[model samples]
Target: MLAIPAVPDVPDVPDGARPRWSVMIPVHDCAGYLALALPEVLAQLGDRDDAEVVVVDDASTDDPGAVVARLGQGRVQYRPNPGHLGAIGTFNRCLTLAQGELVHLLHGDDTVLPGFYPATEAALADPAAVAAVCRVRDVDADGGPLHTTRSYRHGTGVWCDALESLALSNRVRAPGVVVRRSAYEAVGGFRTDLPHAADWDMWTRLAAHGPVVFVDEVLACYRRHAASDTSTRVRSGANVRERVTVVGVVLGYLPPARRAPLARRAYAYAAVFAARTALQQVRAGRLPGAARQLREALRCLALIPRGLPRPP
Candidate 1:
């Protein structure tokens, strides 16, 4: 049985202390892009008396030390892991070290718009909000917009309805979301074991605990490049297994009565994703890869109840 680790409690803010926000950026061989991302992050600081920028270098052979060192200053807190901890481990460590009201897991290659701080500050004024997530624009490596922002729209505020939406698809891009320090700690932060779907796991856990406000405005830019891990996941099709693991976690967290419906959707999504992967492999003339995808499809079917409606 996999146990969700306990998220540590954040200390109470001292009176008169400057309001601070902790931003964690994890990078591996992303030197070329951080140059643009770092400055944009600093610009979003606004009037906050304190802001801590945590950058973790995951043992990249491409001189990550030199690149990060150049960007480091009084406001930026940089820590380089001894060796490669991979992206998930790096993010977990970053969250563990945060001391602020809000935590932002900004990817090393992604940049926030100038208005990000003002928008977040206003939304978090509500005491019930555990997280404030805004719209995000996907851009090429050079920061050109891919198209209209990828929509994660559901409603203005977080509630049970948002949880159902997430079960269907992960509309919340990892970077655009800002989490309360206490909320993140309560959910035990990110689970390193599920490296591929760590963000999905965190989002699910957070939604289960509290309401997540969706700010429809696009406050950040997600930089997409061929070399990015996400692109690699699409090319190799490992996203299917990760999504399966996520559904299992969701089912484990839900009540028995609610499990069947959620499981049905999950299994169907897994089957479709696996079939798509198999078709892609066939087109590439890789017989073995295609066969493996077919096997995955069968496993997905086994998880679904026989009488459940098929996923669209």
Candidate 2:
């Protein structure tokens, strides 16, 4: 079994000297897209050798490992995992390998916009700021604009706004943001349990610890392809159920004083999601899935008329 060195809690080098940004890409059979993505990432670096790009290949069936290796750029380092552990594991592994003060969890298939590095660096310059999230545009496989954008406000405090945001919707998409390594570790990073929404989970935790600077400018183009996990979830029509699961877990993490209101809101969102899921399944002629969603929606709706309660 191949074992790469664990990501150190703190790089041997001091923060005063470590790279300003650590661009981390977690890959699984994304070779076809990496070639297009890597150069764009490099271009965004803007002559900053203090930034490093660590690409962790998660045992891809395609030769992505070799592709990343051939990039031959000293700023970019490549590592292959022992086996396939899916996206969450790949993300965590890449986090472990990062050496910079900031780690941007850029997916292998996503392309960084022209101003990504500069915008992110400016956000992290403030000592109190723990993260910087830029606008993200959803693009088709051919890189055409899909007219969908993930946008949010400059949130106050650490992970608090993140928690509240997830309670609302997945506003801070993974590729849309960059994280301070110290703050990221303070929150203990991504939750392996929520594989489908791990990025949302991490963002919630991250936002609780410090302030997240919202770059109003679009700094990334997130590819919406069938092969991508995001699209797969949408196509499977499991988005509603997956979101419900995420909300439940996030509600559990809130304080007792906030849980009740949050839970009520989460349930309401779940009801809407359930109804949507039921509709999608019915349209697809999947009676079993539709029936299951109908039950879930009914259960949520039944709780609504009872009035929203304060947190326990």
Candidate 3:
């Protein structure tokens, strides 16, 4: 086996001086993007003494440390993993190391817009809310706009019926949300078994405990690139399998009476997504991959009850 590279050292924070907000960027070998992402994040923090930024490098071969060191300007903290930790492990580590009342686990390549902090902080102001999410703009690799998303209806200062909305789909992206640290501790960090839909799973768990607030405006950018883990997982069909498994896990969080209806809707949605994936595979002339996706789609469809109406 090849040898693993050692991580760079990070400065230790003094005990009992936790910040109000901890922006944790978990990165793996995407230094170029990190160079772009960190500046915006720091600018958003804007001399706030009550907030700290941390970059958790997950044993990437590339020089993410140097990128953070340069753009971070000594404001951002760096914590490189001692060994190779997968996405879930890296995320759990970020939660563990973060010392804040609220934590935002921003991806290395994604960025938050100007109003992200203020908007999300306001949404989480309600003591009953455990988390807050805002709309996101999906951008290309070079930070050009692709499309914006509004998973929930447009309305400022709205508290979503999170459990009801999240049961249908993963409405919130990881980069577009801020979670309370205490809520995270209550539910535990991201599940190790869920490689693809862990964020969705985490959201569902959080919503079950307390209300989740929504900010109407676009507050973050989700970078879409060929090299992204999402793209790779979608192509490999791991995304399909893991998403199906996630729906099952999330259903268990619901009351017994509500589980069947949600499960039916969830499986139907998965089937439709898989069917679309199969079509895309066919368009690319990958007949074998298309066949595999078709099979998965059929399996999902079969899981749904026979007489249930299809999701709109």
Candidate 4:
């Protein structure tokens, strides 16, 4: 088994020194994007003492530290991991290092739009909700617009049925959501096991604790490039298997009475989507990959009738 590297010493927060918000950017080798993203993030902070920005460099071979020093200009607190910690490990490290009422785990490649802070903060003002999410706009590697995903319901309010919506699909992009630190500590950090679905898993678990507020406007941009972890996994067909596993995990977190019906709905949806992907693969002349995906689609369809779910 591959082991995750140990986290080095993170700067300690003085006793009773808590900020209103901690915007944590975890970067591996996305310095180009970081240069663009940092300015936007810092703009949102606007020299506010109650907000802090922390950038975690996971021992990248690239000069992310130099980038931070140059663009961040002594404003962003920079921490470099002693060794390599993968995305999940780095996320856990961010949770450990964050000392704020709310934590925004923004990736180095993603950017938040103006009004993200005020809108999300207002939504989370409800004491009953543990987290808040806004709509996400998908952008290309060059920051050109691709498409926008309206992950939440069509209004600006707290959604009590967040788990049900999340069970269907992950509506919260990492950059678009801000979670209360207390809720993160209670549910634990992102699961290392579900690499592709870690964010989805975290959303489902957090939703279980309390309601989730949704902002109707697009508040963040998610970059889809070839080098991104999601793209790499999808190309290798790992995401297909991980998607099945994520659905099962979400099912386990739901009430037992609601599990069976939701499983049927979820697997049925997966089967249809997989079949479409298989057809696309075949059209692209990847015969073996298409056959494998066809088999997965059939397997998902078979499970729908039995109402029996299994983890990958």
Candidate 5:
């Protein structure tokens, strides 16, 4: 098996008293956005005794706790890291802090749309599923809608035998997924190796554990800003490099017969995606970023012939 860092076991809690859901908001210097995200979650959890929300600050310069206090009004708990622990570490920290049957690590800057929790919960009613994901809406810095990701199917249901389809690409976003706490314990916490595409890795692992429920409707907003981790990596072409690593990692979980062809398909898709992003950057007048992305695109094209390594 590939060695991913293990997520520390959740602290023992009495089974009967535990909350049904844990919405852990992991924040770092996103107080302004947290102000917007917290309310949407709070509205849905209104008067619900079984759900808990908490904001885990990653030693941000800004005060996300203040936002939690002002808006959460004791409804959302706040915890600060002793020191800066970047996004990945903060996510694990949130995992450790969570005390619910189902955990949703909501990015501090993202929000779940109305009916998101209800719809996903309904879909997850089947006891065999380990996770439930709704469609994500990409939004700009000011919360303006950009576009929604494509639906995996016509409606909400368990994605039966979805491993091969998911291994080729990461189609879900963090804000859209709510995983079982035990599943996090089973696979491991997020790692630093694939910063820009970590969610892809986690989602694939969840798919492997068992069934993954999907709600085709757009039920969450994923914010994209110039300074976000993804945009920063895109500018340096690191995102494409990470995509290559992620594709390699995800393929290891598949059957040997399926690896090679899927590798080609994935590499081809990555190249095309990089090229498209490069073109978008060029139109946006980010010439330097465009150049870096173009270089990564060429690298992806080169990977088509020599397939990525599979697990031994």
Candidate 6:
């Protein structure tokens, strides 16, 4: 349904030997961070063999392959794109290349804690679960702890309010969630148009199919740096504009009766975020970016037309 590229034939490997998990790290120009991520991933694997670690470089100028070679040797596979495809392209490419039942779309820079795999695997062990999301701890570029995502549940269990809650706002960070590959096939690839907010679109869609598991403990680290896409969007005011589009797309997924109230809630939250970013931009003398953010704040439900396209 996602119109993904035709997958190649699987050369049959005995079930015991084939990898059950693929930790695919999609990267652009972030080799320095890749150096740190590889070891942490492998360390969790230990002597276990049912995991594949891949670095899918998005035609970055720097050499992340050397980092993979130095740290991983043959354990980690390094796959480089022929050309630069930006975030949307690279992420789709990672999905295409992934060869495991469970897919972890880890960033080139992020690292999972020692307990992450075990915790997530435990949650996914529930046959009804289509995906498992762990709480995320935000870290600075130097890997210093910033803050953790607010917990949606009191402790680890099924996320009962997942769909309605995510329709209002995305709480997922890429490294913090491990998704079943089947979920991707069902939802389709990330929307090519929503570059800045595709993950939000994807997670919200996934929540609809899920008995999603919430691992309340913070098991994944999401790095924040000036060069990161989130930061760039904030500086340019694209975050607000992109979120407005994503909110409209997501509203189409819910029942008509719920859309009005949720749309109001979503738009208000985005407006508040934009206003806060606008003030920060003003303090930094980025007047144009501040003005751009303010303009997006006023783009409410009326901007979203009727007969919107729903998720696959």
The 0-to-1 C-alpha lDDT of every candidate, in the order given, reads: 0.74, 0.72, 0.80, 0.82, 0.86, 0.81
TM-score of each: 0.83, 0.82, 0.88, 0.89, 0.95, 0.89
* Clash tally, candidates in order: 3, 12, 0, 0, 0, 1
**Runs of candidate 6 exceeding 4 Å displacement:** 1-13, 279-288, 298-312
Over the stretch 244-277, how does candidate 3's per-residue lDDT look in tens digits? 7777677767787887788788888888988897
Model 1 reaches what TM-score against the true structure? 0.83
The sequence of per-residue lDDT tens digits that candidate 6 reaches over residues 1-312 is 232333343356786876788899998889999888887788887457788888999988889988888998589999999898888888888888888878899989898988888889888997678899989999989999877998899999999998988888888788989988877777777777777788888888888877899989989999998888787888777787778777778876788888877877877777777888788779879888888788777664344343332232
> What global local distance difference test value does model 3 have?
0.80
**What is candidate 4's lDDT per residue for 37-108, written digit by digit as tens?**
898877878488888899999988788888888888577999998799888888989988888888999999
* Residue 251, candidate 1: alpha-carbon lDDT: 56
What are the per-residue Cα lDDT tens digits for candidate 1 across 260-285?
A: 78778778878987888788678868
Number of the predicted model whose TM-score against the real structure is largest: 5
lDDT of 2 by residue, 159-262 (tens): 33555766555676678788888876777756766778777767766666677777777878888776777545554546656676666556655676786677
As for model 4, its CA RMSD to the true structure in angstroms is: 3.5
lDDT of 1 at 241: 63
Candidate 5 Cα deviation (angstroms), residue 183: 1.3
For candidate 6, which ten residues in a row score worst on lDDT? 1-10
Regions more than 4 Å wrong, model 3: 1-16, 279-291, 306-312
TM-score of 5: 0.95
Those runs of model 2 whose alpha carbons end farther than 4 Å from true positions after fitting are: 1-8, 14-17, 69-72, 154-162, 235-237, 271-312
lDDT of 5 by residue, 171-287 (tens): 888899988888888888886666567778888988988899888899999999998878888899988888888888889888888889899999998999899999989999999
- For model 1, which pairs clash? 7-185, 7-188, 158-212
Between 1 and 5, whose TM-score is larger? 5
